[model samples]
Target: MSDTQAGQIGEDDHGHPAASKARLRLWLKLLKATKHVEAELRENLRTAFDTTLPRFDVMAALYRAESGLKMSELSSVLRVSNGNVTGIVDRLVDDGVLVRVPVDHDRRATTVRLTNAGREQFAAMAARHEAWIDEMLGGIDTSEIRAMTDQLERIASTNAKREG
Candidate 1:
């Protein structure tokens, strides 16, 4: 069974407790690893710019989309709801980090792009973000990082397809 299916009683070669316990352990291990990475990133973001990870994520997504992206696109990319995107966008817009422009094709549908100030801020923070990611994973060897990244990407893709 996969790690997530670790609910059934498991057995070892000696017939000791096996089934679900092993899966549970795997899940717990994954969770702990994820939590450690997240905490490190959270602290890095906090110290570097006094911003939360979610806000950074939203901004980074906008910055990456050269021509900007619609709220729907942002929502899908960020795996957040429209209301959540709206609030984040509103906050950023208030701070002049992003602008909402009416769509030429659909007036009601607005596209969000980083403003000059937003671009500048993102650029500054981006360098720091890259540094932090590198530092946090510095102990990981290059091959390991690549392998883990590929595995995680595959898992994420499967999950997205499953959940979406």
Candidate 2:
């Protein structure tokens, strides 16, 4: 079959168009699965913890950085714009869950970190978040999960290489 015909039906034996079609399908399935899990997590976070996914994400980043990260650094780590991080950090600061510390050398720059309370709160939320993921993926076998994780990691590495 010609490439266009092979692509249309995913029937090529030699593999360019067929592989492309298969990759497209895989991408769609991955996106759908991700969105499904994300939506569930978002709702769970909202109902159980009275928090939004973005807030949880910000906390998660800060939780990993013990010493704290500057506002710009946090924005970069989260792959979000500074303005977007600003509002969430502001709210978190107001709630006493995070604190802003002035940078010694840069008067205008400040680093943000989780407070003790924030750490405790995130530890609990993280435990539950893990459980939620486990429950959702309960049907998948451990070996299959590992294989898929490896494949995804490869894809990420390849994409990063391409970008760099």
Candidate 3:
């Protein structure tokens, strides 16, 4: 291997480069791309709706569940702590965007669903979000999209296998 390749891999046992170096580089590139897109999304959400990304994510999960979801379910679906969700839910409730209903036959349990106004507001945001994503990824062709999607799916499967 060349000096640069050796530097990248940090020198192998026999003084050659390691095989895992390419995978490490790929992981960093993927992380960078994800952060770039996420930063743009955060800025757009802030400027267009005067809202944060976490608020948008919570609404999105509630939007998908027409019948609403329990507090635990919301936490699990959003992959966030209950405290994080509770703060956002409280703000949204104060804004008249979500309504908390006592679960049937269970006074101790509460479920959250979007109000009519919330539905309408989310629809508007969702439309703009879709457009923003399309604009950002507009340069990538359909074939490349399909190829990348397939590769990512394979990677996910490999990761799942390890966990399982």
Top candidate, metric lDDT: 2
Each candidate: what lDDT?
A: 0.87, 0.95, 0.92
For model 1, how many clashes?
Answer: 7
Q: Over the full model, what C-alpha lDDT does candidate 2 score relative to the true structure? A: 0.95
Tens-digit per-residue lDDT, 1-164, candidate 3: 88666655465677655656667788999999999999999999999999999999999999999889999999999988888899999999999999999999999889999999999999999999999999999999999999999999999999999999
Cα RMSD (Å) per model?
A: 4.8, 4.3, 4.0
Write model 1 residue lDDT over 33-111, tens digit each, in one string. 8899889889888987889888899999998996899999999999889988898899999989999899998878999
Per-residue lDDT of 61-112 in model 2, one digit per residue for the tens? 9999999999999999999999999999999999999999999989999999
**What local lDDT score does residue 20 receive in model 2, on the 0 to 100 scale?**
72
Q: What is the Cα-based lDDT of residue 23 in candidate 2?
A: 85
- Residue pairs in collision within model 2: none
Q: How should the candidates be ordered by TM-score, best one leading?
A: 2, 3, 1
